[model samples]
Target chain A: MSQFFFFLTAIIAVAGAIGVVTLRNPFYSVLSLVCHLFALAGLFLLLQAEFVAFAQVVVYAGAVMVLYVFVVGYVGGDDETVHPWDGPAQKGIAFVFAGMLFLELCLAILGSGLKALDTRGAGFVPGFGSPGDIGELLLTKFLFAFEAASVLLLVAAVGAVVLARRRGGIHDEEQRLSFTEFMRPIGTGTTAEGVGTRDAGINLPAPAAPAAPRSDRETLPTGGERP
Target chain B: MNWFVVVSAMIFCIGGAGVITRRSPLVTLLCLELMLNAGNLALIAFSRMWGNEEGQIFAIIVMVVAACEVTVGLGVIVAMYRRRLPIDVDDMRELHG
Candidate 1:
């Protein structure tokens, strides 16, 4: 039963990895990565690394992939025109090298045999790789590195905010407006439009009338205003 | 037992191929995540083999580091995109000497 599950997990993982490399749409690739991460988490469970398995799901599948999707959506150029096989020669060379590396690793592992593995006695320890065990070690033996990781996370958050921040980005007042109100600026009684007025948060006057005729240029910019 | 090692190696190799051949920075980043995951799996396998909790703790640390990496990486990607930078690695000539 375990072997069957392992094979299933392995197949799903490999297929997902292939999809990640071969898929044209990055959004689809990100989805494939989620699938791959879940399969990896299953493999983690098979290895009895319970805590790592759950973290794999929560962090990689949940947080990281969401971040990828967010970038794909916000940046909005995920569909690259490059064909997967556009550089068949390069890909072929890469595949050949990678395959050779895999073959070498296999030969090494097979030659080493089970004797190479340092199995500590033939007894299964209950709660192995459990959260409790990991937490205890993290606070005790690995305390310094654990604290360092927290600090690293804080730094990363601050860095991401700084890096993605727009110069002269949405001002404090502009930040408060909904998308419709900001773009259309048809209300709020400021009665002015363009450069400085828009920045100052003055309410621009509503157009003379909804049915009033406007030139192509005025309507072109807004793509025809939404309600 | 041995199969775990084999699977991990295969995954690592595939990830390496993706990183090398894929032109998109996002795809490269995804492949890097795969490589990190492959290492984590091998570490866990060794942990189980040796009956030690240390490898598991190390795996958690690696995951934290990978998270930090992705955060910064995606931020840079977004920043680059905002500047209308091409997503292809070869097209980025800002560092050209």
Candidate 2:
């Protein structure tokens, strides 16, 4: 049963990782990451690292993925705007290099053998990876590191908020405004003829007012017009 | 189990491949998280085998650190996106003088 569970999660994780790499839509890629992290949590359970598994799901899958989803949404779906031929050769080189690196690591692992590292003491006790044991260690032997981690997290949170909330100086504001205008949907009640034009930086005159839809008059009764 | 090492290696490789070939910064970030999780799996496996609390503790610490990295990294990416900058790794050469 345990082996079955492990295989299940391991396959899910590997497939999700592949999806994260190959999916063209950034939204789908983020979803795949969420799937990958959830499976990782299951793997943690299989290893009996209960606390770490839960933390993996809560932090990486939950919080981190939410942030990623937001960023992907904000950036739009098609952000990889490089032309097809621009860097195909470099991408190919990268794939070959990565494959070679993987082969090296695999060979090293095989050469070293698959046995666990020898230790001075016996192997871990049952429930050693449980939350209670972890909490005890956090408050005792590892208290200093725990507190330091908390401080680091606090600083990170503050830094992210500060960096994101920064209202840049006037020039930045102007640039940002133009970018927003550029990103606005073309047909959102804007009458400007040049708004949807392909030309860069050429603002043509606004088109005439759109004719009122005859369907509106036809759908409403003679005296049932909206006030 | 030996299978743990094998699976971890496979995951590490998949993540490495993703990081190597993916163009978008967001995809690269996702691949990085995959790599980090692969490391966590190996750490936990060793921790389980050793019967020690240290490995699990380190894994938790890694989780905290990964969280911090994602927060700051995504913020920077979003900031760059707002500036109309392409979020491609090759295009992000502003750091190069």
Candidate 3:
């Protein structure tokens, strides 16, 4: 049963990884990655690293994948099969390099007598790899690293916000009226022209907007409800 | 455990290939995440092999790092999209200089 389960997840992981690379749509690629991560989490479970497996699902598959999905949505799925930089020769070279690298890695792994490593090096301890055990280690042996990771995450959060800040500055209060208009088609959401032409920078001559002072808050739909 | 090592190596190679061949910055980032996860898989497998907590700790640390990387990469992608910049990795020659 264990062997069968491991094979199931291994196949899923491999297939999902392939899907991620071959799928032309960025959204589909992100979904494939999510599938891949979940399979990896299952593999972690099969390996008895229970805490790590849960963290893998929660952090990698859950939070990180959510971020990727949102980014894919925002960027639009403009995945060209070949780009100006990607010549046929370049593709061939990349595949060859990857093949060689994999060969080297396999040789190294196999040469190390991994079969011997199949035996547990450390004696079995009670409640090994449980979340409580991991948390205990985090607070005791790995405390410094634990705190350092917290600091690192905080810095990363601040840096991402700074990087994402608009060039016009955060205080710019002007809102794009078209942003409120989601009724129009967005051109399949896979073309650059889909979202590009609708951003806050371009305006469409007010579009029969009311001249009333309070019309700024009143979008096209709310005009019907106005007293 | 040996199978796990081989699996990870294969996934890592797939990810490396994707990173090299994919032109879209978002797909490249996705491939990078695949590589990172592959590394994490190997680490967890070894952690189990050694029957200790260190490998799992290292795996958790790798996860944190991966999250940080993805957050920053997505932020950069969004910023580029907002600036009307090309989202293709090949066209990002501004960074080469």
Give the top-scoring candidate (TM-score): 3
Per-residue lDDT, model 3, residue B62, is 86
* Candidate 2 local Cα displacement, residue B31, angstroms: 0.9
Per-residue lDDT of candidate 1, residues A1-227 (tens digit): 98899999999998998899888787888899999999999999988889999999998899889999988878774566565556778889999999999999888877876664644323457989899988999999999999999999999999999988775544543443443344454433343444345444333344434333243226435544333
Better of 1 and 3 by DockQ: 3
Clash totals for all candidate models? 3, 3, 0
TM-score of 2: 0.77
- The full ranking of all candidates by TM-score, starting with the best, is 3, 1, 2
lDDT of 1: 0.81
What proportion of the real contacts between chains A and B does each prediction keep?
0.70, 0.72, 0.80
| TM-scores for candidates 1 onward, in order | 0.78, 0.77, 0.79
lDDT of 3 by residue, B1-97 (tens): 7889889999999999999888898899999989988998898888877788788998899889888888888889888988788888877877731
lDDT by residue for model 1 (B20-89), tens: 8887888889999988988998898888887788999999999999999999999888888777877788
**Candidate numbers, best DockQ first, in rank order:** 3, 1, 2
Q: After superposition, how far is residue B78 of candidate 2 from its true place, in Å?
A: 1.4
Cand 1, B chain, TM: 0.95
Error of 1 at A14 (Å): 1.1
Error in Å for residue B82 of model 1: 1.1
Error of 2 at A112 (Å): 1.3
